[model samples]
Structure formats: structure tokens, C-alpha cells
Target chain A: MTSSKDTEHPLFQRIEGVRQRTGRVRDPIVTQAHGGGGKAMRDLIDDVICGALGMSAQQIQEDQARFSLAALAQYGDRLAFTTDAYVVSPLFFPGGDIGKLAVNGTINDLAVSGAIPLYLSCSLIIEEGLPMETLRAVLQSMGEAARAASVHFVTGDTKVVPRGAADQLFVTTTGIGVIPQGLEIAAHQLQPNDAILINGYLGDHGAAILVARGELQLETTIESDCAALHGLIAALHDAGITIRAMRDITRGGLSAVLNELAQASQVHIAVDGTKLPIRPEVQGFCEILGFDPIHLANEGKLALAVPSEQIEQALKVMHAHPLGQQAAHIATCRPTPAGLVTLDTGFGGERILEMLVGEQLPRIC
Target chain B: MRFVSEFRDPATGKKVLQQIEQQLRQLGHDASHPLKIMEVCGGHTHTIFKFGLEGMLPPSIELVHGPGCPVCVLPVGRLDDAIAIASQPDVIFTTFGDTLRVPGSQKSLLQCKAEGADIRTVYSPTDALSLARQHPQKKVVFFGIGFETTAPATALTLLQAREEAVSNFSVFCNHITIIPTLEAILADPSLRIDGFLGPGHVTMVIGLEPYTFVCDVHKKPFVISGFEPLDVLQSLVMLLEQFRQGRCFVENQYKRLVQPQGNRVAQQAMQTVFEAREHFEWRGLGSIPHSGLRLREAFSAFDAEKHFAIPAQQVADPKACQCGDVLKGAIKPWQCKVFGTACTPETPIGACMVSSEGACAAYYNYGRLSTSRKLEATR
Candidate 1:
């Protein structure tokens, strides 16, 4: 249990004072009565959801969250909205869980758009048999993560389904943020000779998830690289380096992200294979299972295209951040032969990458 | 990763390239038609294309991707049998993840799985065996498919099943051998391959003695290489030096793991539980005699083929698909009539387009770089 620094904000502290008189769900496990809109549901919501998030601020009694237009306007000129769902198997994994992923993943969706993520709305669909302890732990994690990232879980919903209806728990988080004035990062802005930079090691989350499934019977120390990225992006913006375009490497991994960027920007990207910062254990896992690290998922890692002259400054800012300690300049963007991505193997050959067609099945041959 | 990383040195690879180029110059070979070499293992083909090894080498050298991928060569009829068996009630069909998407005559195992069949992908045969132990009332069948390197695992698993008296555990053994298939390829008069990068894992199982015929009878150079980049380059140097001196024989460059006699314990396990079938049908090539293996009479009780009746129909490859030519080095994958057109990986009309290790799939995935017509293939 870690303390959340952002919870010390005066606005949330006021809610904390009011929340001290709330009710509790005495049941050890969730049941149908929790979804019946009765006293049971109110206690579950008040004690579990609002209690863990640190600030519900009257949103539980209301249908929608209220925000100050001027306060939001002060942060930026435009509003960035994004949504994602997490139905990951086993809900809990090393370094993070569905709760942490729900917070960080949605925050990243806004941050990568050059926005300062301000608030998130969470909805949880918990299966009937889920232990009350599990829900509390997950909600607690969501609160800690959001609080630590200086974002608020201003509104939320919780529903309990029949045991067979869901796989333990499902979390969906929607985030909105503000894009500061004069910040115009986009894929189409990517130009020839632009350098591609990454925050840290690639594919840890994907490898960690695959190994956590216990299908391959492999032993590894790899953990999911799940963390909030809005702060890291803020550091980059503070340095005043032009970020041509930025994308968090999540599902379909970096190759898929680069392919989309290349197509959108109409530029060819040449990735130096040696420059990729993949951990040896992750690489070995991919080797044994016949998976490509470039096509594997990451939660905290991001790829950004920046101007050639701004490369060193951008990297210096990234290196100073706690999350971007292993930041690397990996590839160079060039006018193509558009919509093509290639990896220079460092063995004197260039291997072209296509979007991974489907699930990266392990090869036996 | 110790032994593995040591063999991927780019510096050593460059030095080997110099010697190989020098040796080729001395041998008087040029890029007019090119000196063709066949690496007769899908694992080797994967390495060659993955590292862009074929493109990095001298332009005069061409690597003929052989019919070594078991998933690629699995006949449509056998796949149909597997699907029919898997679709049965109270039966759990297990296979390597690589074989899940391979197209059968009608549908693939993955499609069948999607249609509510219990087809599970396992990393090893033992995992399937565990499933059988866990579900005693249900039939658990491991779809055992590979060449010599993979057959031993299936063999050992079957032996363990017998030892444990696990009645529900069985193997759909689609295991194949290397020598007879090589013999069949060599017998083809149309192929004019100059040398061979021998299948390292297969050679490690059958041992080097079995490949002496390729030198004595066929008079073609053979070099068994490791899967790593540097080992491949070093093996090419060995093969080229032999070609420079007009020598033809089997040489082992993967001495770290591959021995002259191979793993005796694994060979012993294989000999105990299995015997070669008289003839086995290949997808590209027709029937090759004594090429595939099946459970021995003593272990027939643990054989899935014996346990369940299947639609053992001989389904033909599509009329336009020329996978045979690609496997035999007669033409490049792109040269096929339906290659990147009617026979793409998404809707593969040929068996070769099914597996990543297959030359067609590898080419379609890794080699299709250009937006329009492909670059002249270095493979």
C-alpha cells in the first residue's frame, strides 16, 4: 500500500472529509443483491468505488460529472477524449493489474496526443462470484494510480453480473485531457530524416502477460511495464522540443504503431535493430517462443518522431524522467516508397516488417 | 543465451563472407545463373530469411527453401483427418501453435476450434499428456508433427504414457524423416542444386552417416550448419571451400550440439516406440517411400489414428497452386500463378502459404517489402 501524493490536493481532501461518514459492504463476496439498486448497491458503490478512489465528490448521487470550463481552459485550448476496455485474463499480473492498466492505459491514450490528462471515468463489470476483497484491492489500486498521476476518478459505475457472464472482472476507463496552445503533434507532421525515439525497454508487458498465462511453462523475471505516462510527456513538453508525433506502444506492439504512423505520414521508417532496448530475458522469451519483440505489447513504452536537430535535447529531457531512464533514439524517418517499415538487422541486411496478421503463434519448426 | 548469442557475431560473419567470396572467385562461379544451395530445413529457412542472410550473401548464391516445414508439407488429407478427429465429442485435440492455422482440405484446426471443437495448442507433447491425465474420461490426442528433431519428443511422451498406463493419452503421429525425402529430391532430374546446407537438427538425430550417399551417389557437397548467423556463414565457408576443391561429402559445422552419432538416448526412445511408414504423401511432392513414421505395433494402443476413425480422404492441392515447384527450387514463390494474388496468406490455396516456416508464407510476410511488384528475391 503506497501513499498517493496527488490525494493531498485541497479539492480532493474536502471530499475525503465528507467520505469518512460513508457506508460499507459487509459481504465477503459480491452477489445479486449488490446489483438490485437497493441499500446493498449503495453501500457497495459508496464503500468500494468512492471509498477507494478518494474522490467521488457527489458524482455517486448524480448521473454525470460536472467540470469547470474555465479551469479546464486554463490548461489547454482543445479537449482530448479517449476510451479503452481491459478484459485481460487473470486480472492481476506482475508490476500492475487490471486496475493499474485501466488507469495508465487510458491516461496514455490522452498523453500521447500531447494532452495533460486531467480526469477519468471508470466502469467496472464484476462477475458475481468475485470476492469483495478482490474488488477492494483493484479499486484501491485504481485510486492510488490515478492519484499518483495527478488525475481524478471523478465518476464511476459498478455492475455485478452472473458468475458465468464475465471472467472475474472487466474495467473500462475513459479519460479527457487538455491540449496546450501551439502544440500541434500529428503523424502527418512527421518528415524525412526525423528521428524516432522510445521511452524505455520494449515488450515487457506482452512477455509478462504471455508467461503469466502459464501456457508455455517458461520461467522469467519480466514484469509488465505499466505506468502513467502523462508526467513523462509533460517533461518532454517542458523542454520545448518539437514532438512530431507520439504513440504509446500497446496492442499490436511498436511495429503496428509504426506501420500506422508510416501510412499516415507517408514516410518510410528505418529502425536500427541494435538500437532497440529489449531486455535479454524478454528477447530470450521471444526467441524460444518464436515471437518478435517489435510486435509485442508494452504499457509504459512510447515511440515518438522528432526533428533531427532536436534529437539530443529531447533525449536528455526523457533520460531525466524516472520512467524514460533507458530512452533511446531507435529509427530514422525518411520519405519513401511510402507506407513501408524495415528493420536494419545490424548484420548487413534489412528485414521488412508487415503488420502482424493475427495472433503471434509460437513456431514449432 | 550464452551459446546462442556467441554465434550471432557480425564481425565473424563479415570475415566468413570475405573468405566465401574469395573461394567463390577461385571456383569461377558467377551470377549468370547463380550457384544454387538448398537449406533443407524450415528452421534454417526461417533463420536465412529472418536475418536477411540470403540478401547479405554474394549475389551468385541462391538458397532453395526445401520442403522441411512439417506444417507446410502436412497433406490436406491428414489435416482433414485431424479436423474430423478433433470435432468428435469427448476428445481433446492438442497441437503445436504453429500448426493451428494450417489449412486443411475444408477447414483448419483453428476454424474447427472456433466452431466449438476442443483443439488446444500445446508447446510440447507432455502438455497434451498432462491434459489426458487431468481429463481421464475424455480422449486427449497430441497431433505429433515434425521431422527427426521433433519425433523423439512424441516418442518419449508415448513411452511415458505406456509407463504410466495412461489409456486416454495418444498421439496422432505425423512425424517424418529427412533422408528419404532428400533422396527423393536428389532423384529429381530437373533440380540442378550445386550443394546442400544439411538440416542440422535432423542430422543430429539420424547422424552424419546417412547423408554420405548425397556425396558418393549424387556427388553434391553437404555441410550441416547451426541455426545462428555466424554458424551459417562459417558453414557456407566450409561448403564453398569444399566446392572450390571439387569435394563432395557431409561436414558438420554445428559441432557444439550436433555429434557424428547424434543423441543416442533420443534415438533409442524413437526406435522403441515408432517405425517408418512405407510411403507418406507430401503436399508439394507426391509420395516419398519410407519418409514418415507411425506408432509401432507394441504402442498401437496409444495411437490416435487407431483410436478414432477419420475421413482419410486424398484431397488435392488447388490446380493453380505450384507449391511443389517452390519447394523443389524449380521457381521462386512469387513466380507461382496464384502466389501473391489468389493464394495470399489470409486465404492460402496452397499448403506452403500456411506456415511461417514455409517458403511461401515467409516470402509473403518478410520478403514482400515493396508496395507494388516485389523486389527480385534474394532467396
Candidate 2:
């Protein structure tokens, strides 16, 4: 290889001319040798990660992922970047695993910013005793999910810690995307009379994870709604729905996202408790454990604030999309009672829906 | 889901609200002439705020939040005892999830857990027994805290542990009785409560006749209410009807669950496993005699207090906290000195600010806007 001092930067040149070092990992399970920073590490990186990603082994040998800036700039005027960590217990859940969750979660973060996600970086902190086959399965899941979302994993890292240093595995993903020119979206941009809309039911992921933990014996079939939403967001952008702001309802659930928007815009958000989209199984689970579905978490769900005029069109487009079949207009923002969000109980009464203070631990009462 | 959803029907809820209004008008009361009703269970308090029941009513009828929340009423001294048991290295301190945030004198159970304590939040006491079975070497102690509604589960769990000879399982019994606490509230002269909204879950265990002391002796109207929005509204009408007829006795609005004699099997289990303490110190209401339960001598082997040394010191509520006044219905939660300004859910100074079922938390989280609206109206 030519030294950079006399050669063109890789990002500025064609990557096709680079040479690859073919290797394969032989061990049945991950061990300390995989993290030795030597040939074994190289083998694991090349054979496992690169093979699953369908990329040349030399692509990960470099210290950095180099993509042509001129080519990336053609898609949009601005770049959006975001990162997320997945440490969900039991790593594998009903519908998704840590790998799939990591990819979708990061993509959703960028999608909410009105960006078309393109490339991602993955880092896996694995416990020494995890089976190689399990790692292979997870990597395969990451590859499949990324392919489905039309995003590429250009760079990655794998660290094997001593046993007991961490749980079985942890995945952190950083995504980069481009925002089309003139497309602006933000929580603060929300205004009065904006119709609050959400895609699908709330709290499926949280309920699914809770049941998967196998602590609460009462059971019904419920699965996590983990999915990539960049395509759904793109459809709205394409349909000219005038999307003002959007957020994937994650950790603290739908109420947390709405509270953030209300606080930023200094507006009152009114929602009908009855109109909220919740699956019967989720409702039954919440009923048994004294949990409010509104406070429960979701992975694939998104809450968007659209201008009142485009409410019908936004719903129509979202309903047509595969990921947003249950899209609903749930709320409307008003100017008064600033920085507050309220729920109409449909009992001729109204109450404030505050941000959750701490972990929504199950209550004994 | 069937029974639960039916109780929440808005059409039926609207009819209940109309009937409540009509009964209030027949009693010749409006916003100016208020009838103060105290719902004496944390579950009822939760139901009220969860459905915004307060805003549906005329301002003249005030619902006073009582000290029925077991977590809110759990004295900090007892929480310190619980933390002490939890901090032991080999002890797996199991408790209901809601009690994790209750502030003890030294630190909360959650804080201890973060600092390497083996704390687990179990859905039921039997889950603790399962833990004891799984980890035979570790000591499993269930921090039992609730009203009669949750007491039976712990009682039954202890019995099963005994039969199975689960040597490592024990209970830090903090289960409380509702009768003595209700008696303490009724005796207080500072409060002027016109009626009572009874706790349905507790009544499901103890039944209707136990409330005779509440209705016949005190001549106060009592309605055993269900924990639903419309159930709450309908119960208010039933309570008001008792007032209009100038009759005072125990009424069962939640007839679907409560029997006059209650569940004999649960009562039998509790009677066998537990006995009243001489005096149990409440967080806000101090030293209500025979209000809390402890394991009986026969089941002393299953009691954690006997197995581990407990602090048992009486820790006072925070100086600025007016939870006692709020619990006694002498003042509204917002009228307290530290209500929203100093004591909040994020940094709670009192037990009332910790649990979702607690009145202050229920109001602060769900009805804080009404307080602002009232201030604006006054302005």
C-alpha cells in the first residue's frame, strides 16, 4: 500500500483497488483470544462481521470508514448523526434482539430529524462465554435488518470482556443520514392546532420485554414492535404532509415524548385517553399489573405533530405504509396552560399527564 | 378486561355524573356549600386521579385524600428497618415495586440496591418463595406492605413456604389493617368529613359488616366503592343518597366483589399467620394502636424481624412536609408548604410524594393543572 503522504486519501479515491486478507474464525464460542488485538481478532472481524455484512474484508482493516463526501452530498444539503445503546435484558425477545433493536433504534432517531439514514457503525461488547453461534445469529439479524432498512454497516468493533464483566452482550450503533434541502423538523417547531398522530399501538415493546423476562407468570401472546421507521417517515415527506415534528416513542413511552414536545413548544397538548391505540393484550397486561399503557414503552411507534390542515392526508399516507397500519390522530395542541399535557378521561373530566419521574416499576397497590 | 372495560364506559360514566349532580342539588349544595368526602384507601385515591374524577364534580364537593396508601403511610423508621435487612450481603430483599422509591431515614431501598444490595421487586409474595426455592443458599426476605387486599397473599405464601419447608424464606411483615387507621381519622376533631368512600379491595377481604363501626357508630355515610372512574362517580351518588335520606349506614356500591362476610379463606389464612402489633407508627399519622401486623409466635420462624436485627426507631416526617394535614383532610395537598415547590416526585420529601397511589403524587402528576386553574380563578 502507498503511504498517504504520496497517495490520494481513501475517501477521495476508489475503494475497489484495495486488497483483502481472507480469514475465518474456527472457535465454536467467543473466548479471550478473540480480543487479543492480533490475528484471531482480525479473523473474527473479517470472517464473521464482514461476511455477514457482505463486504470486503479489507473494509474493516482500516482505522476509519471512508465514504466520498461529494457523492453523499448529492442526496441532501445537511447531515444528521445519532447513536443509541441497546442493553435490553434476555438479549433475545419475542420479535427482535439486541442487534435488530440497535439498528432500528438509531435509524429512528435519525428519521425523526427528517433524515434518510445511509450508513451505521456497530460496536459489540460481548461476554467471554457467549457462544460463537449466538454471535453469528445476532450479526445475521443485524445484517438482515440493515438490508431491509436500506442502510449499510460500513464500520464495526467487537470487544470480548472477561466473564461477569458485563451481561451476555451489548450493542451500540451510530447512524449517519442526510436531510433533504428545505426539510426542517424539531420539537420546538410544534405549534397550536397541530394534530398529534401516532403509528400503531403504544407499549407493545415494553409489555413484550416484561413478559419475556418471565417474571410475571400471567401470559398472553404479545410481541415487541421493534422496526425501522425511515421508510415510513420518507413516505410522509414524499406525500407532502408538512410534518412539523416527530419522535419515536421509546424508553419513557408516548407520554414522555408528548411532554417533551409540550415543554419545548410551551403549549397544552390534549389527548383522549379512549382514542389511544392499545392492543387488548397490552391493556389486559396493564390491567393485571396496575400499569398505564400510556407510560409503557414502544420501539417501532412514532408520535408526529402535523399541521391541522394536513391531518387527513398524514393519516391516509401513514395508514397506507406497512409499518404504520394503525396510524391514528390522537391529540391536538392548544396555546393555553403552557408546558402542560392533559388527557381527556371521557368522563367529563381532564387531568395532567406528567413526565414519568423514575423507572416505571410495577406498583404493589 | 371485560369487567374492567365495562366499568370505564363513558356513556355510563356520564349518566353517573348526572345522577351525582341531581343528588347534590337535592341535598341543596353547590360550589359554595361543599360536602367534604374522604376516600380512605390509596387505591381509591389512584382511581380518582387516574380518571380525573375531581374535575367532573362540582367544586362544592371536595374529595379529601386519606392515609389509605400503605406505602405513603409506611413510617420511615420501618423503611430504615427494611433497608437494613436489604443491605445484608446474603439477603435477597424482595418487595413490591412501588416500595422501592419510598425514602427511608438513611436511604431508600433503590439506593441500597444500586450500591450492590440484592434487591428484587416481586409481583407477589409467592414470587419470593420461588426465589427462596431457586437460591437455596441465599436468604429471601419479602418486605410485605399493603392493606388487607395484599395481606392475604403474603399470609398464604408463608403457609406454603412452611409446608414446603423452605428454610431460607422469611417475611418482614408490615401489612396494615384499615379499621384502626379509619378509626384514628374519624376521631380527629380537626376534620369535618361528611361521608366516606371505602376501598373496594380492602372491603373484598374484610367485607361490609366490619364498616358498621364506620356507619352506625359514627353516623357517617360510607360507600364501598369500586376502583373505576364510573364506579367512583356512581359511589358518590350512593353516598349522597344516604345523606339526602338522613340515614347513615354502610353501603356496598361495589357489590360485584364484596360479600358482607368477606372471603373466609383469606381471612382464615391471615388470622392464622399474623397478629396485631401493639402500636405501629405511620409516616404521617403517628402510632396508630394495633394498626400493623406481625407474624404470630407459631410463624415466628418465617418472620424476618426475628431473624435480623431491626432499627425500629421512630423516624419523624420531614419538618416542612404537611402530609399529615393532607392525610387528615385538614388541608389540600397544594396548600401544603412544600407541595410542588420543594417536595416533588423527583426529589420527594415525604412518602406521599413517592407512590402513584399517594394523594399528593396522584394530584401532582394528574391534577396539578386544576391547582393552577383555581389560582387563576382566584386571581
Number of the top-ranking candidate, with lDDT as the measure: 2
Q: How well is each residue in A244-330 modelled by candidate 2, as lDDT tens digits?
A: 888999989988999999999999899988779899999999988989899998999999999999999999999999988999999
lDDT of each: 0.89, 0.89
Best by DockQ: 2
Displacement of residue B109 (Cα, Å) in model 2 is: 0.7
Which lDDT tens digits does candidate 2 get at residues B138-219? Answer: 9999999999999999999999999998999999999999999999999999989999999998989998888898887788
User: What is candidate 1's lDDT per residue for A1-365, written digit by digit as tens?
Assistant: 43687788788899888667557688999998898887788888888888788875476668888899999999989999999999998778888999999999999999999999998999989899799999999999999999899898888777889988999999999999999998998977789999999999999999999989898898899999999898889898888889999999998999998999999999999999889999999999998888889999999999999999999999999999999999999999888868888888777667787788778899885
Error of 2 at B158 (Å): 0.8
How far does residue A156 in candidate 2 sit from its true spot (Å)?
1.1
What C-alpha lDDT, on a 0 to 100 scale, does residue A101 get in candidate 2? 93
Off by over 4 Å in 1: A1-23, B369-379
By how many angstroms RMSD does model 1 differ from the true structure?
Answer: 6.4
Assess every candidate by TM-score.
Answer: 0.94, 0.96
Candidate 1 lDDT by residue in tens digits, B331-372: 988889999889988889888888888998888877665312
- Candidate 1 is graded, for docking, as acceptable
